[model samples]
Target: MQREDALRSIDVAVLAGGLGTRIRGVLGDTPKVLAPVAGRAFLAHLLDYLARHGAQRAVLCLGHLADRVTAWLAQGDSHHAIDVVCQVEPRPLGTAGALRFVRGELRTAHVLVVNGDTFLDADLRAFVASHRLSGAEASVLCVEVEDATRFGRVEIGADGRVLRFAEKSPGPGTINAGVYLFSAAFLDRVAASDAASLERDVLERLPPGMLHAVVTRARFVDIGTPESLAAAAEVIGEGTP
Candidate 1:
C-alpha cells in the first residue's frame, strides 16, 4: 500500500508510561523513552519510524516525568501532528490498564499500539492491513528469537491465529515484538481498573481463534535493559541490519 493511503487508515498509540524500574541502574531519573540512543532521545527515533511508515497522528500515554516529555516534544513541533495524552496513574498501571485510560482517544476500528521502549523494524502498514483482512480481534507482531526466556512467547496455528501466550518461556520460540494492531471492540472489554495486564489478562483469556499473530522478518530490539539499550544505539548508529 502507498504510504499516504496507509496513513489515512490508521492511528498510533505509543505506550510510554512505564517507570523503567528494570533499567534504573543505567537510566536514573529519566523515563525509558527519553534515554539517549544515537545522540537523540529513544522516543524521537520511535516517532520518526512511525512517521516514515505513514502514521499521521500519534497518542503518547505518559506517566513518569510526563511534564518533561511534554515540554521537550513541544520545543519545535518535532512530532508533526502527533498528539500526546497524559495518563497519570495514581499507582503504576500495567500495560492493558494504561491503554484503558486512553480508550476514548483511540476512536478507530483498529489502532496500532507500540511499546515506547522497543525498536521494531516490521512494516507497520502491512501488519495493519493483515489484521484488517484477517478479521481477528487483535493481531500481534511476533519475531523468532534464539532465547525467548525473557519475553512472552506466542504459539501460533497454521492459519496464523494465536493458540496460546506463554509468558517468559524457556527455549526457542517466537516472542511478542511489542507491536500490535488491536480491534476497537476489544477496548470495550477493558475494565476501568488500574491493575490489568495485557499479556496475562487480555491476550491469555481470548479464545484460540480470536487473536492472530504476524511474523516479522525485520530486526527488532527491546531497549528496556542497559545492554539492550547499548545494542539499540549501535543498531541505529551503524544503520546496519
Candidate 2:
C-alpha cells in the first residue's frame, strides 16, 4: 500500500521564512534559501530534488521578504515536472506555524517538510515509507554528525522512536536534518493562533515516542552561515548525486 501511495499522494512543503540575520553581512536582504549557489538559486536545487523524487506539487511557506520567493517561483524555475505554490505568511510565524498557515493546501495526508536552508540527500521515498509503515504521526530525518553543537541532538530508541531532543551542545550525536514526514493529523495538533517553532514549540514539547526518526549517514548541509554558503558548490554542483 505504501509503495503505490508514496509516489503521487505525498506533497512537499518547504518552510522558507527565516530572517537570515546571522548571514546578513553577506546576503544583505536576500533570503537564505535564495542565495545563489552554482549560479542558480538554492531553491532551484531543492525543487529539482523534490521533483526528481516524483513529488508532483510543493507549497512553500514564505515570509521575511516573501515577495522575492514568490517571484522566483513564478519564474517557472521548476521545469516540466512539479508545480510549485507559495503561501506568504502575514507575519513571521515560526517553523511549524508556517506549516500550519498552509494547512489547507496539503494534498496528501502525509506531507514532506523540508527546511529551505538545509538540503539532505536522503532517499525521500524510504523516509515517507517508514512513516507510512510505522503509522507514526511525525517522522524526522536525523543525520549522524561529528559535532552536534551547531544543531540540536536527537535521541531515539532501539525501535527508532524519538526519545528526547537535547539542546544544542558540543558532542558527537545525531542532529536533526531539518527534513520531516508529517501526517495531517499531527499538523492539526498545532494551534492555528500560536506562534510555533518546529523544534522549540513542537518537537521538544511532544510526548516521547510521539515523534519518530530515521537516522542516516546522509550528505547534508544547512546554508545558514557564511562559511557553509561558500562551500555549497561542492555539495550542490552539477553532476551531483
Candidate 3:
C-alpha cells in the first residue's frame, strides 16, 4: 500500500489512562496528556503529529481524570482535523487492558498505539511499511539511548525480531520507545482483566519471533516524570513528530 494510504488505513490509539503518579507533584489533578508543554496541551501536539502523517482517526483512551481530557477536547483545543474520539476506561485498566476496552471502537485491521506522555520523532509512514513487510503480529519502535538506566532494554536478533527484554541497568542500549503497531488479532489476545500491564503481561510473554523491531535513531522523550516533562518542550518542539 502507498504510505499515505497505509497511514490512513490504521486507527491510532493514544494510551493516556495512567494515574500519572510520577508527575503528580508537578501537575495536580490534571491528566498527563493535558499537561502544559510549550504553551499548549501535550495532546494537541500528538494529534497534530498524527494528522500531519495522514492519520485519519484517533481514539484517546483516558482514565484517572477522564473528565479533564474530555473537557479539554470539548473546548475545541485540538487544531487538527484528525477525527479524534475519547474512550474513558471505567477504571484504571493498564495499557493492554485499556486498548482491549476500546477494541470495538477501532475500525481498522491494524492499530498504532502510542503513549500519550511520550514522543518519538520517527517517520510513521516508514514504521507502518516496516511492520507490514515483517509480517509479525506486532512491531515495536526501538530507539537507542545514551543511558538506558531508566528505561529497560530491548534485545533484537540479527533477523530484526525481538529476542527478549532486559531489566533496566546503567548503559547505552536500545529500549522500547512505547510506540507500537499491533494487528487486531494481537490486541484480542490481551486478557479480559482490568489491570494487565502491556509490558509485563503481554509483551514480555510474546515469543522471540512474534514481535518485530523497527529500530530508529530518532529523538525520544518520555514525560512520565517531572525532570523528563520539563525537558520535553526542547525535545518535542512545534510540529515535531
Candidate number achieving the greatest TM-score relative to the actual structure? 3
lDDT of 1 by residue, 152-199 (tens): 688899999989887686887798898888877766776454447877
Q: What is the lDDT of every predicted structure here? A: 0.79, 0.83, 0.87
TM-score of candidate 1 on Cα atoms, chains taken together: 0.91
- How many steric overlaps are in each model, in order? 0, 0, 0
In model 2, the Cα lDDT at residue 56 comes to 83
Q: Give the CA lDDT, 0 to 100, for residue 74 in model 1.
A: 69
Report how far residue 129 has shifted in candidate 2, in Å: 1.5
Give the runs in model 1 whose Cα sits over 4 Å from its true position.
Answer: 77-81, 191-195, 238-241
TM-score of 2: 0.93
Candidate 3, superposed: residue stretches over 4 Å from native: 1-6, 191-195, 238-241
Query: What does candidate 3's lDDT look like per residue over 32-151, in tens digits?
Result: 999898999988888877877788999989989999888888888778778888899898878888888998888899999999988888888888989989998899999999999999
Model 3 residue 107 distance off true place after TM-score fit, in angstroms: 1.6
| Residue 106 lDDT, candidate 3, scale 0-100 | 84
Cα lDDT, model 1, residue 59? 82
RMSD for all candidates, in order, please: 2.2, 2.1, 1.7
Name the lDDT of candidate 1. Answer: 0.79
Look at candidate 2 and tell me the lDDT of residue 62: 90
